[model samples]
Target: MASAVLDHDPPPKHLDEDEDNDCPIEQVRLTVPTTDDPSQPCLTIRTWILGIVGCVLLAFVNQFFSYRSNQLSISSVCVQILALPIGRWMARVLPPTIIRIPLLNWSFSLNPGPFTMKEHVLVTIIASSGSGGNYAVGIVTIVKAFYHRGINTMAAMLLTQTTQVTIFTPLNPPLKKKQFLICFFFLRSPVAGIRLGRIVQEILGGFSVHVCDSIQCRALNEEERRPKGGLSRLQFFLISLGCSFAYYIVPNYLFPAIGSVSVLCLIWKNSIPIQQIGSGLRGLGVGAFAIDWATATSWLQSPIAAPPFVLVNVLAGYVILIYILMPLCYWTNIYHARRFTFLTSHLFERGGAPYDLDRILDAESFSLDVRQYESYSDIYMSTFFAISYGIGFATLTATLSHVFLFDGQYMLKLWRQATSKANEKFLDVHGRMMKANYAAVPQWWFLVILVSMTALSIYACEGFGGALQLPYWGILLAIAMALFFTLPIGIIGATTNTFPGLNIITEMVIGYILPGQPMANVVFKTYGYISMSQAITFLSDFKLGHYMKIPPKSMFVAQLVGAVIANACYFGTAWWLLTSVPNICETDLLPPDTPWTCPSDSVFFSASIIWGVVGPYRMFGPGSIYVSLNYFFLIGLLAPVPVYVFHRLFPEKKWIRLINFPVIFGATGMMPPAKAINYNSWFVVGFTFNYWVFKRHKQWWGRYAYVLSAALDAGTSFMAVVAFFALGNYDIYAVNWWGGVLDDYCPLANCPTEAGAYIPNGCPQIQ
Candidate 1:
């Protein structure tokens, strides 16, 4: 049975010219397979072992990192780096005995052959699934850290595991043929039983045969298989690690004092020109570090990673909009930017005090009491945040316009081609592999997952008073929203590597639906936003598996198992940190130097208050100072029309098509969570690698660019995890010198006013 399933002809030498020409440029150009090795062992014992271990490590590190102020995630590059050696080592050591299932009639060798590229990729994907902070951790962090509520660790683990498991289950194949055959045999009537038996036999027979039997699966040469100018795995891993270690040590330990320098503080220092020069140097150092960290992983993964010119356009947009425009706006005091310390998601009163929701909440229900809320003064936002709203709205409209203008015809054609049975042919090598080797996930499985999770979510919300008592209708509405936006968002994400987040849209909708119920609003938004996002994520992984020539069944099992392991590890790690770390998420209790500031959670909590408790109607409604911001949506929608029109009118002018308004507008909001240093630094790094290196040294860039990205991500994340547990938790200092201090070296970075209206800590008094 295993031999029959594994059997395949050599891959085709040349792709169908007609099909290739018809394919969208992006899809056709980048769809090249990683290898042409037909005998590559995909599902093997070594792959499983490495995948499981990688998943656990990644999950723990990701969850641990989530609490830090910088908000670094353990990138998938880490797993990609770590998996190669382990998989190969296991392949060498593990026994190769062929194991056969008794009733299933399936037999497979434990080790298979040497660890192939497909196996390595599968392991990395599985590990990546486990790594990175899951949204479920937010519930635990917010409940325990902010609300000061007690949650059972076991219960939390169970709920999180169940949620993740159910979410990924829809990606799996249907029940095995044996189970269906067993059911079919129970028919009482002889005629019905005979008919059903024949149908079942046909199905079973089909499952046993290989789909590649009909198609020619010819092998290609190395040049044909992989893109030219790429480095080996080892080269990327080692260099990135070295660079990442250097990056972490220099700013963090060796010269911490140079990390952040403020112009205001320097000028205030007794009118010393040297002090101003020192401040500029400090800014340069900090900006360099920020750029190094932010751009390392992102550049490698961006859609224009290989294309220098396209990357330059993106960098241009990022630099002009974020670095140049935003700072100019701030300096000019546009929208009263000087009145706020930071442009964050946090809500504030008109007086710039933190909006105290506890003052208005019903003590027993924890819901907003209208009478109490009415007694409080009007809520206000910083100029930065107000602009963020405008940008967010603008970006959304711009993205839709850009897609419609540039990719509309292709998208429509693709959709029609996908739905039409007559033209249903595999367009690429990966598509052919999918058709030849695997059966798609059944629709019924998706329905089952949807129904089960919906039920579980309702129970969690209503049954547990502490879990935010959201009604069933709100949950239904969230699901409907997910269904509505999934296709459009998914298409954009797949093509452009940019997902216009549904956070704002979902929050706005749910806020209106269930106003004054902060918990309910948040819960509804989570369901609406995350469900579709996760689905898209799973689909991407599935496509990745297809590209790597992994069997669909194996990919499904790997994801399902990886998700379960990740959930458990994440929950366990989160619980440990919450208990073991002293005064987590409490700035007052911990020393100023502590990394466990929980900035992400703080942002989440603040968002809940703004979109959930106070509601947008009172904040951005009629007569409000920010009411003018709502029209930005229309402005966003119209902004891209002209650019598209010009491109169409003068197709020969290549420069006209270079302007991507969505990229520019989207970059404007990258402050607070991200700082000016990050933007400035990211631009420099992006230009150096994506522009200079890619254009000047194309061979070297293609070989080492992505590998460098992976290595840096792995090294930094691994070192961070090690540092926290080994030295950070023990309250060990890295020699208290000026260079090793934690401050951005900017005393007046926040720009505090004379009225003490926006006085953040460490700012100098203006006497």
Candidate 2:
């Protein structure tokens, strides 16, 4: 849907009438400063050194944690915070020496006055190279761990490089129509998806940037003073951060059960049915809550940053999907729902046993064996996992239709305003100032880079032993897909802070066309998915520069350099662990206490098995049990129609306009990884800060809401790293009391609800 409430926001009159307060988006008008400092230096010596170091540090730390079960991603916010004091220190200690290249007539200074906000922003942009954490590294992990195959370093590094680079360029049209025929053969039920995709592309006419990032960067630039008797922004942030750091030790370590305590589980400790209703991680989570910010905002994020309506709509949708619909389906035993646990992501065989994935795969080729598969039972999943996919399917179409119906014309206006010089006066004052001040990066840069990367991407898959059987034609389709979805997805992500991926769609297409090639499927999925996501990141960086008034050419240089080094470091780190760490990611072979499970990569490996090896022909093709779910396309396509009509019927009813089916349906989109505690706690905090406090205490909320969010994130990242090293790494230092367990004291939540179901490992089964 329209990501945030900024589409048609009325400009506020708090600022002086003649000032630069005429930005179309209200949040930007409110947060970004009206003036610029043209004399302030941007690309100083402090910027490059700090940026490069931050990029390497983040890449190493994040990749290190990726293999552990308790994964902690260090964000660019961390660099934004940590680099400030060091930057100020460098500004003081370094000599004011001028360095000039006489041949090129270029000059720069060592100590460029006090470190400027523009410099701080440039450093964060550089660090952002590793912020998304190299999506292609999972290919290295899954191949080494799951497939047990050795890869060519050149091939792996090329795959990593291409995925890390995000580009948006027009491509040469279909070379041979014959290749299109082969792709078309694979488009069966996904043909139904054509309308869904068309719905999104129909209204792709605007550009936006991450609203939350804008809010966070306010600290680095703005010079406003705190009111009388109020804490300064830095003091308030440090206080809140200290509190966050100290408070985490309780719920995250000493008293873990408080992280997600379910009242029903505590009251009826022995009742499986009651526990099933209350278990936060593995069940319905009827009365669950978490005190820990890490647990509460694990996947949902700190709600203090979201708009009130966004939080309410998401929570409303989550309750309907998880509490009402899922429980009903489970209780009634649809598709043998009770045969599995309530909230698991695991696949199962019939009769309640875990699916033996290796049993159906050919050992040598890593492809599905029809003979072995015929003897084995059909694939089954928890009702939660199956239904969630159906929700995702509907959400895509709903997102497309909702955006088109609600936001199309406004976005079209923005596109026109952005492109034509005649409409430049109507543009935001910030945009006008940026254009006036900075030399723009030449368009030819993108053209040259796109051609070079596309060529390398092809050679990475095809030239390497022809092992990755993705033909050159597949790359063309992938680029086409990425170009099509990038703008639409970017709009939603920038506005709502929610980014939906094309991994599923990409895998479905290639797996169907070229089944039995695992690397090909995953590599293609990486290309299709990461291209759009990284491109969005690239856009967000530019927007950050846009708001901060950094020169476009300087920003371009910073990003290009950072991305290259960060991509290399990320690959080097993953490759080092894969080669040196004994039995890494192999849980059975490692010691009982080993912490190298590669949880995300395990899921990635499972996807390769599901889509690549077995292919859609077996999973969702004709005669498949899930074939019925293909109708979600029709359901989603029609969902937004009612909302659109209602708005037309009664334009005065504003709340009706706020009702977004995609936001609600997509609320449960992160369920496989996110628990109910995340959603429930997020909604409560968001409502308190953004709604109640926003109206009740306007001054305080405006000054501290986003600052508080940033502090909490930074503190949590720091503590997580400390906790991992101090206590989480060893059994001896871990808390020994009953409170140490993180679950809601609901052991039975792992068991099946069906009367005659078999339990794995001979766990007690109900009769």
Q: Who wins the lDDT comparison?
A: 2
Model 2, residue 231: what's the lDDT? Answer: 83
Candidate 1 regions off by >4 Å? 1-40, 98-108, 152-233, 261-337, 342-345, 423-430, 442-447, 754-767
Assess candidate 1 and give its lDDT.
0.58
Q: Please report how far candidate 2 places residue 278 from its true position, in Å.
A: 0.9
- 318-436: candidate 2 lDDT, tens digit per residue: 88888787988888987689888777776788888878878987877766787888899777878887787778777778778877888788667655543344543544676556545
lDDT of each: 0.58, 0.69
Lowest lDDT sum, 10 consecutive residues, model 2, at 181-190
Candidates in order, TM-scores: namely 0.81, 0.86
Root mean square deviation (Cα) for candidate 1? 8.4
Candidate 2 Cα misplacement greater than 4 A, ranges: 1-35, 64-73, 100-107, 169-219, 222-230, 411-428, 572-599, 727-733
lDDT of 1 by residue, 48-85 (tens): 77888889888887787778755555656566656666
**Candidate 2 TM-score over all chains jointly:** 0.86
